[model samples]
Target: MSAARHPWWYDAVVYQVYVRSFADGLPTGEGKGDGIGDLPGITSRLPYLRDLGVDALWITPFYTSPQKDHGYDVADYRDVDPLFGTLADLDVLLETAHGLGLRVIVDLVPNHTSDQHAWFRAALAAGPGSPERARYLFRPGRGKDGAKPPNNWDSIFGGPAWTRVPDGEWYLHLFDTSQPDLDWRNPEVGDMFEEVLRFWLDRGVDGFRVDVAHGLYKEATLRDQVRPKKPKKSAESMVERVLNDEPMWDQPEVHEVYRRWRKVLDSYPGDRMAVAEAWTQTAASMAMFVRPDELHQAFNFGWLGTPWSAEAFADVITDSIAAVSAAASAPTWVLSNHDVERHPTRYGGGPVGLARGRAATLAMLALPGSAYLYQGEELGLEQVDVPPEARQDPSWFRTGQPGRDGCRVPLPWAGDAAPYGFGGPDGTQPWIPQPDDWAALTVAAQEADPASTLAFYRRALAARREVFAGADEETVASAEGDLLVVRRAGVTVVLNAGTTPVALPQGEVLISSAAVPGGLLPPDTAAWVR
Candidate 1:
């Protein structure tokens, strides 16, 4: 990552690829199930990513893991899982990405590790009250009452947070029982994570997309939390708790940790960046994750669930800019990810749903900050309807609710084939079944369709780079009803998120969701005009 002629991410587009479902080069039955997608698969897709006009790529966790959390439960920080590929494979992918002018940022789960990890395993075998035990938060094992967990805290996956070790005291897991939280307060813990940070940075990787970053620290008292008003569990619950808004999350000390990371980044020849997954409802809380010397960006989820009304959308943009404008940082918007239902499903049901998906993509990219385009989104892929019998998610199994399989459906690349485009060689099944209707949505099929959403994205990306490329930070002009108008560098973008078309007082209609030239927006779409 040599210093770009311009700032690395300024006006740059980002594409996020979830490793397991991206592409399957080794779609064979020799390894764990159908281990199709590997580093080579990603390297093979670099040209496609570059053609999409994305300058930066964020690959989800591929580190050595127990797969209990689907790579989130990291077992080795410095090693690549054989299931994904080897370190040599990673180097090839990195070299290929840079050759194509794309920067690579891998996911880093700093909050917890698999209980099978050497540290956790050692702590588990060390018995009670050992100094090594201090590396993790452990409390006395109880009796009779199934040994009540050390505290009343509940796992993000459900049940008590404490999991009793067979031979020792219970250990705390903010998430699943197999993913134990790391003790960041311990000097040794900090030192270990710092080494993990340097491992990739030293290897020429650009930076990281930190996972559960705010959840790195827990309450010192380890007290139980009072559930929020919407505590009722549902398929839509992306998080077990509203941890980002909690007092202990972005503690002042967290800044110090980021400062150290920033220092490490500075030691490199290029400008390395880090982004955090912090879910907060307001701009004020989201802004806390970004400061002069801390994280480069925090995922602003305020718009993730926002109504498609113009006023509501405008308020989010306005408030977000106001929150961070003074701090001289940028904002990021992500509408879809591996964890939640696809936007098409969340917005509506059918072709109308596809329209909503395209509309939202344009709206997010048209906004005044760096944007994240999820895998399959450019093709307008809808969520799969996962039946209960075939579900594999722990949350789904525990709560009897559908899990992320809907959004995490296998990717479709080839045209109209069984298992869609993700079919493995020699009749091997895909890791996750693709939507039956994915044949028409396969990347190959859409590649030839000029009116397709896929084409719309290519044009949209060009438009973003052409119009908003060097524009200064934008400000809200008016946020009324289903009309949101914003201006940056003398250009105003007015979006209509409603069913009926709304009147615009100024600016020509540059682009519309339902406009000619196969615009990406659907229904009453967003428009940009002078």
Candidate 2:
């Protein structure tokens, strides 16, 4: 596709802002004084984002919620949570971001809602067999005396997916019990979400990052999931194992939801779009969410799940591009998000990890599509070891696992101390504490040092805009040993994942993840050559 024919989001570099941890506005009113990041905080940081060269920002959910699953369990679809600021605050944020030439995409959680949501409350109060209860997936218990759950499916977080209500009927919650899944089969449910889409579009937001896009529809039969004969070890394998033919996920019926959502997005101007956070086993299944008439993009998680190996990266990139291209859609690349461990930490923490992270990010940017960057990624922030008591992710409580709070720690902006300018000068503590040792990782500190990760990100993003923004072609050359070479728009990117130094192609050096000594690309480094 030509650059002119493509939408703004087609090759946009989107920055993901986990609102509650980005920056705290420190409002003295209501719950705003509790030191959580808010709309005003995001608005205040627009200049920084503009200078960073990101084309757009994808802010995580900030809607009204009890925050059981943070803001994912939204209580009110249209209003901003008081802890994050108000709806008016969001309007200013939108206006300011536009004025700064940055597009804004807010998260839309359509799969479920907070148990405190009015609909869920009504469904509970209205009891079984009522119209209100029909809006959600409420089914009668299976066993004698109606004491058992309707199905044997387990929650992604752990435990049974069904929660029995006081009236003896059970409601399905694929996540935390506080977040009950809605029945998308209900026409009213579909119509209501369409209105929700219009509400944000009319407010001048660019688009939405649809949460759990693969889960809007479930098998009508509601049968128990068939378990694998052998237990899967890794989380990715387990997810693939369970969801491969699971009754509740990646159903063909779910595509209809996006088909309707596409109409709502098309009704607005400014190239409005939506990206699906769908997790499927293969690139083909993931591509289904981004069909021409459906969502504009779907996250290519195959790339994210791949390890730090040239062969793994090459295979994923090839599969992802081929699948999404077949659908006539640009692939979306993401390294880090709110849900997983940061790439640097995952690559193997410390100096080696940071080096690999930079190289990986450079390679991702050189690809032929959109890239979503998590908030603190540019600063090369490693996942912190949050004290168990300080962890807020529901996964930690539901399961004995370490949880995602480490990646969600408050960002280090300017200070040398705890909170690290994440909040106001009053030293109000961030919701999750920032590590005191992050003094060197602060934006202010890194901005002064050219060798710093933040500096590298700025230079890399600027180069990406100047070189690859309008480039329509990407080709991955066969790997020569552990060095993976990719050519895009006349620029060649060489990534050396092996321990030995590798010879570079005869092209003028543009940028290197680390300084190249003696014209040889060192191990765990990537270079852009033109």
Backbone clashes under 3 angstroms, per model: 2, 0
Worst 10 residues of 2 by lDDT: 26-35
Q: In model 2, which regions exceed 4 Å deviation? A: 29-33, 232-243
User: Can you give the TM-score per candidate against the true fold?
Assistant: 0.91, 0.97
Q: Per-residue lDDT tens digits of candidate 1, residues 376-438?
A: 988888888877775777777656778887887767887666555454554445677666667
Measured over all alpha carbons after superposition, the RMSD of each candidate to the real structure, in angstroms, is 4.0, 2.1
lDDT of 2 at 481: 75
For model 2, residues 1-530, the per-residue Cα lDDT tens digits are 77778789999999999999898874774533466888899998999999999999999999999999999999999998888888899999999999999999999999999999999999999998999999999999987988999989999999999999888999999999999999999999999998899888999999999999999889998998877787778857855663655888999999999999898888878899999999877778988888889999999888788898888788778778889989998988999999999999999999999999999999988898999999999999988999988988998999978899999998888888978888877778888988879999999999999999989999999988888877887666546679878888898899999999988888888888998888899999999999
Candidate number achieving the greatest lDDT relative to the actual structure: 2
Candidate 1: Cα lDDT at 445: 87
Whole-model lDDT values for every prediction: 0.76, 0.90
